[model samples]
Target: MKHSLIFITISTFLATIILTHQTSSIKCFDHPNPLNFHQKIPVNCEFATRSLKTKRKSSNDKFQIKFTCGMDDKKLCDKVQKGFESAGQIITSTISIEIPITIDASFYDFCKTDNQCSIDNNVVAGGANPARTIALMDEDGVERYYPQALVKQLPFEHHPNFGPFDILAKFNSEADYWFEGDDSQIKPEQADFQLVVLHELVHGLGFYSSWNDFFDFVNPKGLTPIPSVEGEVKENMEMIFNGFIENIFDKYLVILSSGEHASNITTIINTIVNEKGKFYETPKDFIVKFKSSPQYLQSQIMLQTATTPFALGFLPKNANSPSEAIVLETTLNPYQTGSSLGHVDYKTYVNTSDFLMTYKQDSGLTLGDFMSIGGNYTGGPIGPRLRQVLKTLG
Candidate 1:
């Protein structure tokens, strides 16, 4: 099964890096030190708020990052704060934009006993941590209100001149993070804190897919993109909906074959569906035709129904590689959703010197030619193609 292959392949890949490392013994305190709540936002005061670094004036051109730490280990919080501050500086220096962006995020921890994590002050603890890899745009491929998480969690307010914080990441209180610099040798059991922070920050800055919208419910349960609306459609007579969206990582995507401009994930399905009204038995034979297919990426944003719905080449930065063509993950499985359609084509680029946005941080690779802008993220600057993609988004 596809699920089995994905897990086996990724585990085998990361095992090489993790198998050789060892964990250092650190003394454990009774409980994590609680963060001070003075000067914190009103919504959630469970964590204490601190301004790590306010590099630029509170203007539209600068970026502001507020670190809310809710952990017993003040030292770990300080290190994580420093890592984010470094990444924030790199983003600020990239271009002197007129509009400032403020990121309001919290880094907290939980107590893990045996194999389970105990709940922290925040509402939903243990089961899942609230490390939101957020996107400011509407995630639904359709009109609005795709995921319930977004509907209830819209920004309470946005600054006068600057936009709202695109990212709001929180961490588990008991998570083990490599606190030292990148050069520090990471044992098999230790995770590079800086590397993890850098990767999550990239996703927060719009390096993810809204492709999940296809499977998620549209405005309501009854409605579907059944007769998927490409441009505009009349739903139930009164409502006229325009399903085309122009933001998020998936929308700004450009296919390598120089075909039509794809604005959403429905173009391929819509094109093929229009022909056979169903999925092709053999998916391999459909790739070339899909690329050569006409300009129809704007038909429907939320894919209501599909026989075989899979993500396209949105994640593969090097789809144009002459060495070998990229193959996309078309089948959607619940277990593999995060690793599936949302990431780079790891199978194709794993062994090559291509993009580095796979499931696991292969932190084994390095790049030097492109760090002149701002000498930050020294150990792992954004990959060449990923950098290009980010620039294209702007």
Candidate 2:
């Protein structure tokens, strides 16, 4: 996701925003699309495998992967593809996956014209997400959405509708990226491609949060309404707002000040429904009372708290005390969408082993540089807290 914010008005909301899903064709990879805030698309149980070449893996490695590259230059494409392989190897070696994960990655010029690639351009470095998500009841009896890649590793019975590929990833080819395999000697002006790939791949594996400020106006708004599609084609697509829903990552969020779980507020907001057990008729109808209702006034505390520094935390499943909760990125003043609640605290993790998931990436530093500075260098970029979080997410 890009670090910049795009202010969207209600007049252009419907015309500009649309949900993300897997179709027969390939689309660009962008995360935190507001139209997909609470979308739940129908899933086809029948699995159809796509014809992509699988990457060669070590004999002792349990994790498997299939990679699809979308660039023309054979030399550059090979370098980018190898970077993905190296990143995938680190993840597989860190965590055990019974099923082979598929990734469709590309290096494209995000800035369409030559003039747009100026020094001041806010071009996206890379973006990735699960091709689809499945709704499943967790052990706590709450229904939460899980990424397709994570669901495949579980005992769940869901099937992929698109194909075997679980993640869709893309990178900006115009950006100054250090394509060499040796990440230790990266220059100060270039970003390490492998590090960026590793970070994006982790997001595809379920490191992102559904909680966002999509409905906020002057102050923060509550959780978004669950959305459903009404049209058969993209041009005529219509969205319907249903009940409230949260992702698996949101289940573990807590208020660091009060030691209160974030879901307590969502549980209250989820109860505001009509006689038919639905939220609202349309997105506009929901927005009308988004900040006016009494329930929303109460839940607004959690939403507003999301903008404070070191306020929100992620309490892992194996935490023995409240102090063990991992701090989330809530330091943004107005709560920037896609970068606020979706990442770790940049100030706290930037110089640590957990720097991979921070809000910003240092241009000059490599994985080795961070490891040397942070100490406790492991095999890959996945730090102790991050590894525990991903393992708990599964």
Q: Which stretches of candidate 1 lie over 4 Å from their true place?
A: 1-61, 93-97, 110-164, 182-184, 213-246, 254-311, 314-335, 348-356, 362-380
Alpha-carbon error at 328 in model 2, in Å?
0.6
RMSD of each: 15.1, 6.0
Model number with the top lDDT: 2
Clashes of each: 19, 0
User: Candidate 2: lDDT over CA atoms?
Assistant: 0.63
> What TM-score does prediction 1 earn?
0.49
Q: How many backbone clashes can be found in candidate 2? A: 0
Q: Residue 11 CA error for candidate 1 (Å)?
A: 20
Off by over 4 Å in 2: 1-72, 112-119, 157-162, 182-184, 216-241, 274-282
Tens-digit per-residue lDDT, 11-33, candidate 1? 11111111111111110001011
Q: Compute each candidate's TM-score over C-alphas.
A: 0.49, 0.79
Cα deviation of 82 in candidate 2 (Å)? 1.3
